[model samples]
Target: PPNGAFRGFGAPQTIFAVERHMDRLAEAIGMEPIELRKKNLLGVGSTMPTGQVLTGSVGVEECVRWALEDSDYEAKRRTLGLANKPVGGRKVRGIGASVFLHGAGFTGSGEDRLKGAVELDLLKDGHVRVRSSSTDIGQGTETVFRQIAAEGAGVPFENVSFAIPSTAHVPDSGPTVASRTVMIVGSIVGHAAKELGERVCKEQEAGGGSFAEASNRLIEREGPVVAHRRYGHPAGVKFDDATYTGTAYPAYAWACDVAEVEVDLDTFEVDLLGFWSAVDVGRAIHPVLCRGQLDGGALQSIGWALCEEVQWKDGRIVNPRMTTYIVPTALDAPPFHTHLVEEAYEHGPGGAKGIGELPMDGGAPALAAAIEHATGIVFDRIPMTPERL
Candidate 1:
């Protein structure tokens, strides 16, 4: 009944709430919501509340540009506004859009203290092994881990072994939370692989042998060919916890979400027709995997905005059963269009940033923005069900 962890961390709920206010402000001032968003988005030189300056490869503008053009948000919004007039089936259509910046790692000064590290082993058989405390909790951590490890180590994917996260055997790569696995752990892995790969290459050249043979010889002589790397913040990155001021994150994942919803006038029920999102996640280590994360996070956000309400009385759960608590199923999911923008964070290995929670960051706000044109009501709260309508 209590949400321990969900996609977007706390972003879906907070963004949904914030986007509602944005819509209200836009309507009150007679400004197009999208235009308002465009004017206010943080760009290359924006400063955070904590006074940290955003540096290279910021992609919020790029994300918004692609989302607007690809979704035809303006044309569709105007067309749907015209269709908001009384319809034969008592149904009205609306398009909503939202954008967000989700930080990729621990809030400032945190990573400096974290000092995450990753250790790797090159086996005699030529397989690479990654050792870190980043465990897979069904978020494709295993698949992506292997992908980065093998690619960084210059080995075939089949030759990589992803070790189970063990405190005794593996170095503490920090928690697997805060969307840091790829941006932080993956970077560490890549660094180690690069070092090891370089060594292997040098050994191969010196001995005039294959990579496996060279690696085996090195293992025998060196008593285990291992590469180890520690976390290092980009130069001049600092945070003051006492004042809660400093760089909020080492990097940001910029994203835009466009949602299409059909509102039934008679029943006041909402049906999601389609969803689209554009994101700059540094560079996707694996494009298909990134798309899946986006689609899944957006779908989860849709459910939160529409029907996934938890009833409670005095902090006691009233409806905990699946039959009572609503979540998105395949039947309830909308068609998805996911796009990627590549703005490389300078420190990220292979130009990758963490994006495990970004798609969910913007979905709810986008949906709420669209619903205003269809229903003429500002959604101050979410799960816009028939009862609330």
Candidate 2:
């Protein structure tokens, strides 16, 4: 089947379903729905259903805690759930929340087997060229790579030029997905650059000259001085696709979201009131871009939860055009409060981990839970439309 490439992949489907289920669970138990999530949320050292123990960097628990606290989730839940609220209004209030994890790099041993490579060509002018097979994909990858290379090589960021993926020029770096470019490829490039610098320094010492002079000498003799390396994870990690089991990912990135919604009981029209997200990104190379990702993902998730629907009639989409297939507009989007918590991972380059998929994972669930809290109706399906409600 041909499916759109979504960062959250199928996880959003599960999150939508689970958020609805949490609403049902809350209604049945006469408990606050957000409380239910807080109670059952996954955290560090938590084993996923696949039995993969989170032995590496874990931050979902902190994300959830910060999100809930910052959003004043409990107080809002109480106000939205009042029994005497009018039923015919065009808008009603709701609040919901969800937590999610993103696996860094390729799943399981894919990275180890591929042995992703990066190269640094040290020029005579003290500048360098970073060669790698990774594509930027508008993810601020090039900037981060430059930063890593400069820091590693003890040079200025502007002194490095990156060569984009070309099989004829660069080594095979793994595909650019799973938020692996920074942690995996960046590390390899940084290491190679550092090694090249060390070699230049060593040659300078041996020849009784400065590093700059030795680098120039190497360039004169060898055209261009270069360093190359390949990288992989530790051995023995594996994933099982059939059962969605095994060590699904070697490392996980975690996030938590809280959504406030206003719903119309008569028409089931929903409006976002406010939203907040907390993410533990291991380390944010660019704080602004990281928050933008969270904001964008949250809006996308909100679209999926409340308005955007692939309407089906007899197994065919009835509404495929943008006119009918709705997404969240600026008016539809609520205020967002985002917090980034850095939990440095020892293994990641410069203590960095993945954050790309964390934002989308929890948006739908949180909104759905919020809606249920407001309306006292449980929603299981995604794209909760007025007709469904």
Candidate 3:
């Protein structure tokens, strides 16, 4: 298979499968699909199929609650029965929803062995510079890192500048995948900034001066003040890959999505009417960006459920062009309501965890469930195409 690197990697595919199956299950049980999912929701002590116990900072239940309430899921489900009649002589309506989980940092022992470094450069003008190897893949990582540094260093946000990643300039912070940037690299940066602050404070205390005086003295004495810290996992934690029955993730992020769709029965086309999702991001350093992530992930999951597909012909993607490979357009995307639920983790920097992949996990299942509720038909295929419906 000819493969190219992709951001979401496997989650979008897995979500599609799970969502389609939920719809099937609803049909077999003669129950609303969303009800089925609510009964089977994963919780803090729930063991994933991989046998990893969700021991730390589990918020899947909360994600579901937010989605259901915000979307008026139950009320709409009741209304769906009345609205089941054909509309416009050719229209049908349905609703579906899904919930998903994402592992923060590297899965299992990866973070335990993570050796990322971040440096705080204190300049003569009482400003700070953050240096790390984590890449900003349009995910606002740099902006978040700066915020972490600012909070840790007790300096104004504008007084911080982040150095671009380069082999010659920064330490290997590991690859920016699996939602590790904020949890791992952000922690390293926070620690470095804190250490720098402490060092300056101590220098001032020893010289009978204030924090500001110490900072100025350090800059004068050291030219450019610099502090470095390394982050790694604790010893003895391990996992077995062959068994797929080990600690899957050091920490888990949870999300719930509720999707409302209007189905055109004559054409069998699903129209996304609205979306709502909630995430447990531990702490939202920047609430705007956190909500943005949830909104964006929900939309992406919506695409996987109702529209996006990679058409294959003879083991190659036949529909490579945007025209043929359809994703959700503005008309396809509905208004989204996102809520951030913060549950602090002990080991995270300032009690903050990762939110990167959390939002994408729940959308498909929720949407699929909604569709079954509205149409009284189970859709058991990815893209939920008109032909399949």
* The candidate that achieves the highest TM-score relative to the unseen native structure: 1
Model 1 stretches with alpha carbons more than 4 Å out = 1-3, 87-89
C-alpha lDDT score of every prediction, in listed order: 0.83, 0.77, 0.74
Candidate 1 to truth, TM? 0.94
Query: How do the residues 35-149 of candidate 2 rate in per-residue lDDT, one tens digit apiece?
Result: 7767886666788888877675777678878988898887766666535366555566767777777777877667877899888899866788888888877777777888888
Q: Cα deviation of 163 in candidate 3 (Å)?
A: 0.9
User: What TM-score, computed on C-alpha atoms, does each candidate reach?
Assistant: 0.94, 0.88, 0.89
Which of 1 and 3 is ahead in TM-score? 1
* lDDT for residue 82 in candidate 1, whole number 0-100: 26
lDDT of 1 by residue, 108-176 (tens): 778888999989999876778989999987677778878878888798888888888989899999988
Per-residue lDDT tens digits for candidate 3, residues 1-389, read 55763446677667667766766777698987667778898767888776766665777678788878888877777767326564554665555567776777776667656676777788755578888888987788889999999888888889889888887987777877778788777887888888887777788678967666788888788776788888776443457766766776667677777777777767877777788777888888888887877777677767776778787888888988889878876666688888887877666776678777766666766666666666766555667777877
Candidate 1 vs candidate 2: the TM-score winner is 1
Q: How well does candidate 1 score on lDDT at residue 188?
A: 84
**Segments of candidate 3 deviating more than 4 angstroms:** 19-31, 46-52, 81-83, 86-89, 208-212, 234-237, 314-316
